[model samples]
Target: MDFSTMIGHDTIKNQIVNSIKGNRFSHALIVTGENGIGKSLIAKEIAIRLLGKAEEKQYVDIVEFKMSKDKKSIGIDEIKSIIQETTKKPYEGDRKVIILYKADGMTEAAQNAFLKTIEEPPRGIFIILLCEKLENILDTIKSRCQVYKLNRLSEEEMLKFLNNKFESLSEDELKAVSAFSDGIPGRAERFLEDKSLMEIRDTVIDILKGICEGKLDKTLLYTEFLLKYRGEWQEVLTYFLSYIRDTLIYKETGNKELIINIDKINEIKDIAEMFSFNKLNGIINIIKDTRSKLERNVNATLVFDSMLVKIQEV
Candidate 1:
């Protein structure tokens, strides 16, 4: 995809294009943003641009390295492999590009091992590191790179892009998908085809409702059901976060205009009233932290159980 195809982060795109055009591109570049905010897309675009387009059955010589979720870090061996690849001459383009997705997941040792290459990067090689957290990286490493921060897209921009791209969708379809996308274009795309996500979201909302009504045991049934989809815990938490955010909005504004869960406004109101603002905030923090830890490979059942027990106290 071209840089223009990216939904947001215009400033970053322009900066990168200017850098490439001026032959002043940084050897080390870090792209940081929240999940669903197009960091990976940007990284891929930059890589393709650097590598240039390739013909059929021809190798463009671009290397992509993703941090392993199971390992919770980029291994030293992988870094060594990247270094070896970087040492080679470009196969098809003027420069060889290496895109590292989830560089923040790199272990301390891996980061240290990578520093040598960063300090004296190979000629004609451009390295792009994509991450969500900048603090997780060493300061010396960050100092050697140009760091670009990506923010969430505005609702107007998000809606416009969705309407333009999904022209055949109904108004309700657009609204529903837009709300669930939460101002992220990549997420909006996923929401378009994800028929099962709404059902899972409904289940989460039902669990929250049961808790608010003092039917705490009902969460156990939902929790069991959630575990059945082992790989979907992240998606489940994302929906849960959106559900709580909608409830909080309804509570604060008392305006249906801002409510996304229109069909379940009553339930949102009930939960919003049952918990104090501080309690709700704390629960949200807990969910966010639990979700992060879950991404780092914490057991799903254990995480959900702990979250349930903690939320019950509120």
Candidate 2:
């Protein structure tokens, strides 16, 4: 895919294009961001463009590796095999591109094994490390590469994309999609993939309604329902947060256009009026903190329980 096809991060795309155009390509580069933010897509696009080919198969010089699903980490042997592969000359071009997906999944030993090769990369060797977390990678590995921390798309950008993709989408649908996207284009696109996602969002709104309205029994039941789908806690948390955020925005600004959950304007209005402005911040923080913990692989039940208790305080 070309850079134009990839939504968001126009600045980063231009920077990469310019660097390659000027022949100032770095031997190693790190593309770090949350999943669904298009890091891997951008990396492949960069590799293809830099290799002077639009077709992936035509770029014989490019090699890619994803984290081995059979193991907890990328073993030292895997890294060594890649290092060995990098030693060979390009088959069709002067430059050989090494695309390592989820590079942070590399074991400590694998990272050490990779140090020498990345430190003094051979002629025509270009390495791209795509990772979700910068902290998981070693400083030695990080220092040797140009690090690009990608950001999410803006509300306008996301809305524009949704509008372009679904011509018949209503204003409320557009608003919900744009707001729930959390700046990730892929997350926004998932609305098109999964039909039940919006249903889940509506249920989350019901749980919030129960809690905010002091309907403890219903809220407790809703919480149980939420935990039943514990596997989707991440998606649940996202919609929950987005709904609350939209309500907060409406409460604070009194601007309907600024809110994301347009279809649930009545619900948002009712919920927003139930609490004062100060209470909203605390609730937002509680949910945001819970999301961070969940992202770090904490126990889902414990995190959700803790989050509910804290939110109840508001």
Candidate 3:
């Protein structure tokens, strides 16, 4: 998609345009930002602009490599394959571009193997690495590229885009989705297309209330039931954390505006009374920690079940 269709990141788009206009486009470029902040989207645009060819005609020269779906890391073999293919001339475009998503997930061997290629990149070759954190990438690699970070969209910008795109939502609904999107347009779009996200969010809120009411058996039972959905554990964890966060925030500040589960403020405030401030913080930390562990290829069921049991401590 083009910049006009993108929700925000106006400054990033300007920088890209200016860099190309000034003939300062780097052979190695890194676009780093949090998920759903449009780093990959911008990278694709940069590739297309630099190619100076139509997307359909030059599709052969645009290689997209990513971490394996079932694996945590990109292996050295994959990088070697890229190196072999990139050594050849472009099929149609002026340049051969490799869009490497999740490049930070590359193993040490792969990263070391990649250094030589990027250090002295071949003429008419562009490598773009999209990442969530700069620290995860090698310093030598970072030094070889022009790095640009995309900033989170303001709540106002996210809300404005949501309001303009979706005609059905009321002001409250718009505010709710925008806040729940957490400064990300792609997330807001997901919420708009799938109403069930809100439905599942409410169900998790109910489960949190069940826990607060000392119905531990019932709450864990619900968690087990929800865990049957193979890929939705993250979604469950997200809303659960949102509920716990809202409880802690509201408990500490007595502020409705800070809560993210906008549809059930009263229920959240009621649950807020069940925990001491320290206990609330403990639970929040546990959930956050579990999330981080899950990203490192940890067992989902164990992490989630342990999280449920640990919340009982508070």
Candidate 4:
């Protein structure tokens, strides 16, 4: 896709365009952002521009390196193959672009091996490393590349993007998507494509409403529901946190517009009336703590149980 069509990151796009125009584009570039933040899309756009090709046509000169689905880390052997490939001249254009997806997944050894090529890249070779974590890249490797970080879009920007992509969504749906996407375009797309995610979101909202209504006996039942979607526990927690945040916002501002879960305004109002600001804040804190614990590989069952109990107590 054209950079103009991409949502947000106008500054970075302009810089890239200017750099290409000036014929002073860096041989190695690093693109960093959280998952679903459009790092890959940006990298691909750069490749298309660099190769001077139409977006619909595949260019032989553009090479992408991605971690295998079965592999947790990109090993040294893969880097070696890429290094060998770099020795060959571009097949279809004057410039060859190597786009490494999830470059942070490269092991230290693989990074060190890959570093050799970027340190002294072949003529007309451009290396774009897409990473979620900048710290995972070697300092030496980072020093040799120009780093561009992608930040989350504003709510307004996200809403515009959603409107452009999905015309059928209602105003409330747009607002919910903008808030749920957390300003990430790719995430917003996922929400549009994955109906199951919407189901999970609804379930989480129901669970929160139950909690707000003092359904203590249903705590275990809620935990069981969460466990059923263990693979998506993070998403479940994010949904929980978001609704609680909306409740808190409503409680404090008394403005329906400020709430993210706009479709559930009535439930949010009920929640706001049922709890004080301190209690709402306490629940938010508890959700954050539970998320932290889950990230640490804590027992999911215990964490969920404890989180429900803590919320009830609050």
Candidate 5:
């Protein structure tokens, strides 16, 4: 993809394009951001452009490695191979581009090996490292590389982009997609892939309903659900928090635009009426704290139970 195709991060894109135009491209660069924020796409586009190609599909000498692979824990051997690959001349292009996805997952030895290469990189080769977290990288490696941090797209910008891309979609549908994606373009695209996202969303709402109605025992079952889908719990929590916030907004302002859970607006309205504003605020805080604990590797089951009990009491 070209620069125009990239969504959001306008300033970063301009900087990258200007660097390439001025022939001042850095030897090693780190593109860091959350998943679905287009870090890889932006990195690839910049690499392709640097290699004198308008598109990635036309690049023959470029090598790409996605770090999500089981064998993707970039080790010394992989770094050695990368070094070997970049040392060679480009097959058909002016530059050999190595696009490393999730470079933060690199092992210590691998990072050291990479550091040696970065200290004296190949003249006509470019390396772009993509990572979700910059903290995992070695200080030496980070210092040598230029870093581009991508921010989350704003709500209005994301909504406009989605609407223009999906013109046939209704306003409410677009809003739901935009809100659910949380300004992440790749995740907004996922809604198109998994059309059942609405259903998954409803499943979460049902779980919330069970707790609020006191139908399901919140002791162990909640924790079991969390453990079963550890990766998705964060998303579930975000949706829950957004739904509650929308409900509260609807209650106070009576505005539908502020409500994200449009499909269950009635249920949300009931929930808003059931819980006072202070209670809702407390629950949101509890969920946020629970999320932080989960990130710190706390026992998921225990966290869920404790959070559920606190929320239930309110």
Candidate 6:
């Protein structure tokens, strides 16, 4: 894809383009952002430019490293293989681009082993590390690379991007997508393409409506319904959190424009009326705590049950 098609992060893109034009691009670069925020796209663009490719496709000189399907973390063996690969010259171009996805998943030993290669990379080798969590990357590795962070786009930017990509969608649908994506272009794309995600989002909204209407007796049913999406429970929680956040914002400011979920304004107003600020704050805290527990690999069944009960109480 053309770099111009990208939605945000213009400054970083400009800098990289200028560096490539000047032939002064760094040997090692790190791009950090939340998941689906276009880190990989940026890396791909850089690789294409560096390799003098006219289109976005797999180039013989562009290499990628990522976790195996069965692996939880990238281990030292993989890093060793990458180190060996860097020794070879580019297959089709003057330069070789090595892109590492989920680089933060590299274990300490793996990072230390990879550090040796970064410290003294072969001539004409460019390394790009794509990471979601900057804190997980070792300081030594970060210090040796030029790091760029990608931030979420504004609503206006997101609308422009969606309009460019999905011309079939109506204005209301576009606005809803902008709200649902929370300024992430990749997420907006997913919401448009993934029907199951839309179902999950709708279910979350329904459950919140029930909660606002004081349907405490359906707490168990809600938990059971959520449990069915255990693999995507985090996303479910995110949807829940987003709706509640919008409700809280509307309640506090009484400004419809200031809230996300704009397409659900009536529902948000109803939810806002059903709960006080303290109650909404309590529910938000509960959702956050539930997410933390899930991330820690706590028992999913128990976590959902407890979370539902707590939210009902709130």
Number of clashes recorded per candidate: 0, 0, 0, 0, 0, 0
TM-score of each: 0.80, 0.85, 0.84, 0.92, 0.91, 0.90
For model 5 the local lDDT of residue 155 reads 92
lDDT of each: 0.80, 0.83, 0.80, 0.88, 0.80, 0.88
**Candidate 1 C-alpha error for residue 286, in Å:** 7.2
lDDT of 5 at 47: 71
Clashing pairs for predicted structure model 1, backbone only: none
Q: Model 1, 1-314: lDDT tens per residue?
A: 56766667888899998887787879889999878788977877777666655222224576788766567678789888888888888876568888888899888888899998887788888888889898998998899888999988888888888877889987666776788787778778876667677678788888787777666676666678778765778778877787788878887888987777677778888888887788788779888988887879988888888887677666
List residue ranges in candidate 5 displaced over 4 A: 216-223
Candidate 1 displacement at residue 193 in angstroms: 2.7
**Residue lDDT tens for model 3, 35-86:** 8788878988788777775453337778888787889888899899888877
Candidate 3 lDDT for residue 273 = 82
Could you tell me the TM-score of candidate 6? 0.90
Measured on C-alpha atoms, candidate 1 has an lDDT of 0.80
Model 2's TM-score against the true structure:
0.85
Worst 10 residues of 1 by lDDT: 51-60
Query: What would the per-residue lDDT of candidate 6 be over residues 17-119, giving only the tens digit for each residue?
Result: 9999999899999999988889999999999999888888888899998889899899999999899989999988679999999999999999999997997
Per-residue lDDT for 111-137 in model 5, tens only?
988897886788888888999889999
Clashing pairs in 2: none
Q: Name the candidate that leads on TM-score.
A: 4
* Candidates in descending TM-score order: 4, 5, 6, 2, 3, 1
**Candidate 1 error regions (>4 Å):** 52-59, 68-70, 228-238, 244-255, 265-303, 306-314
Q: Over the stretch 212-271, how does candidate 4's per-residue lDDT look in tens digits?
A: 778799855888888887778777888988888888788878888788788788888887
